[model samples]
Target chain A: MLKLQGIRAGYGRIEVLHGIECTVGDGEIVTVVGANGAGKSTLLKTVSGILGIWSGTIELGSTAIHKKSVERIASLGVVQIPEGRQLFGPLTVEENLELGGYAKRRSGRKAHAKLEEVYELFPRLRERRRQQAGTLSGGEQQMLAIGRALMAEPRVLLLDEPSMGLAPLIVKEIFTILGELNQRGLGMLLVEQDARLALSLAHRGLVLERGTVVLEDTGQALLNNPDVQAIYFGQHGGRRDSRTESA
Target chain B: MTFEQLLQYVASGLTNGSIYALTALGFTLIYNATDIINFAQGEFVMLGGLSAVSLHEAGAPLPVAFAGAVLTVTVVGILFELLAIRPLLRSGVLTQIIVTVGASLAFRTGALMIWGRDARPLPSFSGETPVRLLGATFNRQTIWVFGLTLVIVVALQLFYRRTLTGKAVRACSINPMAARLMGVSYSRVVLLSFAVSAAISAAGGVMITPASFMSYASGSLIGLKGFAAAILGGLGNPLGAVIGGLLLGIIEALSVGLLPGGSSGYKDGVAFLILVLVLFARPQGLMGGRIVDKA
Candidate 1:
């Protein structure tokens, strides 16, 4: 339940996302796929209030959240698992997760409510909970980033490249986990450079080109589209995962 | 000097080190939270010492005097944050730095006018008795100072480890943007850092007064030493500051023991020289992490 209309965002003197329009429907998994520097991550940053927008509106549910502080936005139940796994390096795995649910911990009892479920979801994290987050492997850290966001019990999870730098097997495992979470009704906006995996796990996919949404389609439809095939899937739609086609 | 002499030196060093460590710990805490080297920290300590001495003379009991000193300086720290630091919240670190440094000088000069240009001694709350260990003798005052500093550091460690607010502060230090996203008021956290930093510094001043001479102008050297200790320990690590402070004091003491002029005139130079070499050798300091220079 998030919407961005004609949103423009950028770093100083360099605009990245130019007038981009996108939406995440309630309980739907929406994926944004583009090359590096296509503003995929920038769009997520703008939505999560890490970067301010230059123009346009970003709405979480019906409320305009762009003007709110990052903490306020998070309290409003929009949590982001930023690119690079950026877990608090010196803190333990559990501490990182504890901080993820900081808004809830302060203002209410919501954090305690999710503690059991979070531990259940990432049992390995619970096992090595006391270990420094920096010491965790890339896959573990990615899982931690996701788990940390989940601890927030966010209304909308904005994942910026959860699959980045992971081994192929680990990437597959993580995507499988995301799809499972989506089935359990977690709304997500997954940003990725990998078209095949994102499209496979998502209900709908949008292609970003030069910071603009260039293509939007149902997952299966995009998987078979000729132009999408040419640019991302290969002319023969070769890289489309067999599991997604079967599903 | 005999083994007793060396023990006495170490005892004094430990007491002195505790003061430095406690002061540096505050600096490190604030730096970790806000990434701004608060030059005004020494004034908080100075303010504490001065307040205690002033109130004690005004017929206040020792505990009451100490409490007044702490409250007075805590208010000053909060005021400094609200009035001085609040405006520079969105400004560059350089602006914050210059603004704070200016505040420290203003504060020190203000104290000079208020207290006059004289070194003042605080009455020992505990009766001044020489406590003996082995063949060495040192004042119970030194022991109390070191004890209090140890208590503060341990309490701080517990705060960071066992408390939610402390964990939130640690999280903020690690990632402010992330902490903000988690609904921690960015401003509130920064101010909290300031309050805690100032409170710790004030406590240091309180404990230190019974052990050493204090004057308005002395703020600079104390602040510099505290800062050097923080840098030596790694800017954010409290444990680092303690170790760094002890290391610094021992080195300075040894310089007195070994150097040509030694304590005659070279003691200050010893601290400065160690500071320089530490900056050159391992600039990150002991408790420092993978932090880049904000400057």
Candidate 2:
């Protein structure tokens, strides 16, 4: 389980998330849904220790991990699949996975088993273990990013916009796999701009408006809430397809 | 010049090229990790050779003196890394450049005060013996330079490829945040780079002291040649440094033998030619990266 209390985070000189109060129950898929600049990504980034928190406390179980280095936070079993599928482009597919398990490997753990686990999840990654990661398709890169995080054997996986810029079918497949992961007892905090997919896949969901959490509910309830639909979907529904709300 | 004479000139250039390669290793390694060219690099070489000569003359055995020389210069490199480089890492690239350039100036001035403005050479550890290979006579010293540079490059290649720490360094070079997330201490890797790079440069100085005498101001051109070799090989590629060094050497040697009065005055121009021409064609270098990136 992960908890954040009054978490204020930002980039240099510009505050992104004013103050966030969020929680993820054990083995639950908790989704943070919002607009493009709703600070959803910033929340995950602050938790992952990439962006510094100005006034807040983040806890991984009982450990106060707000001040821990990014690697230390990761070793505590919190792995992040960074936004934009930031795989090491020049490295081979296998190397990207190996780097993901870097901290675990240093303490004399077996990387091969983890590597096998990753390959099991994505057979394409195994097929192109020798190929450069940069050469992979965008959807494949997203799978690679997820597979890379899985290589760490994380207790809590934080995925940011895994469906970003992907085809409809590929996004569905990725979301389906994520549902399977949640069903298999892996806890996740998924941050997505797509409310429909994120809400359905997660057990509970939090709606972020601007930098604040506007609402929190069970996935089914949020799916039916008109307030959730009006603000998040109010503008896009008029221009883009309203069917995206059901995606 | 006769074809045979031209070949001999290239042969001499090869010897000089090895030394340049070693010096450039210092520049390339530091640049790879921190992206700052440590102008003080040449001082490490000067200190190593001069220290060996001074220690030898003061009654130490040659091997012991060489060891002390290497250690002394390595410590100096580490000190510079700690005092001059580390504090300014987050302080902008231009500031870091100016700081390192100043450190090199300070070190050279300090050396001038200690050793005076005199060129000194250490007795070759392997003796003045020469061996004939393929009709070209080579001193035992030239063979040491060639063989030693080869050995160091091979050893470093293995260290980077097979060892955990070296891979960590490579990872850091590629992505510092990811490397840190993997628990690689950024400071430790940067220090190690300076240590290894300066040690190689120091060894280079000692190796060539038998043929090319050492002076405080001599480090400037030596550093330039090394930079050229590193650039030609690829700014950050270790194997490139070796290839670049040898190429620069052969070119310089050929120039001297081919031109009338070229050997005496044309050596420096040969290295410049390679540097200018290589940069003109492939500025990213043979390895395809710049010495500096857009800040």
Candidate 3:
């Protein structure tokens, strides 16, 4: 399980996440939905140790990891697939995946076995193994990003806007893979801009508003709530549209 | 030019080219990892030659002196990163470049203080037996320098392609954040790059010192030439640096050979001329891949 308690973090003096609290249990999918600048990306970055937490307790199981280095945090099984699919563009698909498994390189056979597992999850990547990562389509890059994270064999995966810029069909395929991975006992904290799609795939959902968690509930309940529908589902179309347009 | 004259020029050019290639390779390693153009790279070469000569004078075997020189310079490289470069990493590119320039001066001054101003002569690895090839004569040391360079280049290519740690270094070079997220230590990679860069440059120094006498003042000119080769080959590509070095050497040699009115004095100018031409025509270099802007 992964947990955050009263987490306060930001970039330099500008506080972006103000006392945010969240948790994702084993085999669960918890989604965060917010408009731009609601600290969605900031939250994930803090959790992953890329951004420092000003005050809070972050735990993976019984161990606190808030003060750990990024690589150490990753070695402890909390891996992040960042907002941009940060693939090494000039490297081949295989080389990217190989780097993803770098921490486990000493485990020779086990690492090789994990490589096979990743290839199995995204067979298209196997076929395009020799191609440079930059040449891949947007959807394929996202797949490679997720596959790269999976190579680390994370106990808890933190995903930031995995569906961004991807087509509807491709997004659905990606979410399905997330569901499959979750079913196999990996926990996920998914941050998404597409509220409806996130709610549909998540077991629970949190709505963040300007650096704070405004609402948290089961995904179905959040979907059914009149306030959520009004604020996030575009029922208040004029206000929501204007906000998105400005963003 | 006569064919024999051409062969002689080519052989000398290759020997000089291999030295530049080695120094440029050092530049490429550090540039790829930290994006810093280490001006002290040529100092590593100078130190290598002088230190080995001092050790040899102290009655150490040739291999021991060579190994000691490489090891000492490698330590200097790592310490340089820890003391000088790492602190200014977040201070942006201009500061980093200035710091390296300062470091180059410091290294040169230190070498002068320790080794004095006189040029030191090193005995060639094998006795200087000139071998005749295509009616042109070349020394055994030329063969050693070229052969060693070929070996190092091939070894480096294989290491990057076939080894996991080498791939991790490449990964850090390409995308440091992603590499960090994948449990690769960024500092370790940067440190390794420095060590490798210094060691390679030191090897170059050891190889070339016999042909060209070693002196504390030699680093500045050689370092600048190496930097030119790096830029000419596209800064981040190792193989490109090698090709650029060879090309620069050949161009300089040809200029000296063909130009009228005893143009040998203008040999050094020829390198910068090629550099200017390369910058104007194809700044990305002869073998440089497309430059990708990091996010």
Segments in model 1 whose C-alpha atoms lie over 4 Å from true places: A106-113, A234-247, B254-264, B286-295
Which pairs of residues collide in model 1? A71-B180, B232-B285, B232-B286, B233-B286, B233-B287, B234-B288
The regions of model 2 sitting more than 4 angstroms off are A106-109, A233-247, B1-4, B55-60, B290-293
Error of 3 at B246 (Å): 0.9
Once fitted onto the true fold, the runs of candidate 3 whose alpha carbons sit more than 4 angstroms away are A235-247, B289-295
**Of 2 and 3, which scores higher on TM-score?**
3
User: TM-scores, in order shown?
Assistant: 0.91, 0.91, 0.96
Candidate 1's iRMSD: 1.2
lDDT of 1 by residue, A1-247 (tens): 7999989889998988889988899889999877656788889989889899999998988899998878889989988888897788889987888888777764346555576578887788888888999999999999888888887788998998887788889988899888888888889999876787788888899988888899999987887777776676643222333224435
lDDT of each: 0.82, 0.82, 0.88
lDDT of 1 by residue, B1-295 (tens): 5687677777877776777787788888878877788888788889889988899889999889888898888889889989988888788787998998999989998999999999898888698888777877888988888788878888989998977788989888888876776667778888888888888888888878888867887677777888887777777787998888877776666666666654637777666776788789988776655467556
lDDT of 1 at A212: 88
Ranked by DockQ, the better of candidates 1 and 2 is: 1
Which residue pairs in candidate 2 collide? B9-B253, B13-B249, B233-B240
Task: Write candidate 2's Cα lDDT for A1-247 as tens digits.
Answer: 7999999988888888988998888899999988667798999989889888999899989988999878789888898888787777877787777777766773344677778877888898899999988899988888888887776778899998888788878999898888887787899999877777788888899988779988999988987899877755555321143345445
Q: What ranking of all candidate models by DockQ puts the best one first?
A: 3, 1, 2
Each candidate's interface RMSD: 1.2, 2.1, 0.7
Candidate no. 3 TM-score: 0.96
Model 3: per-residue Cα lDDT over A46-139, one tens digit each: 9899999999999999999999999999999899999888999989998899888777664678777887899999999999999999999999
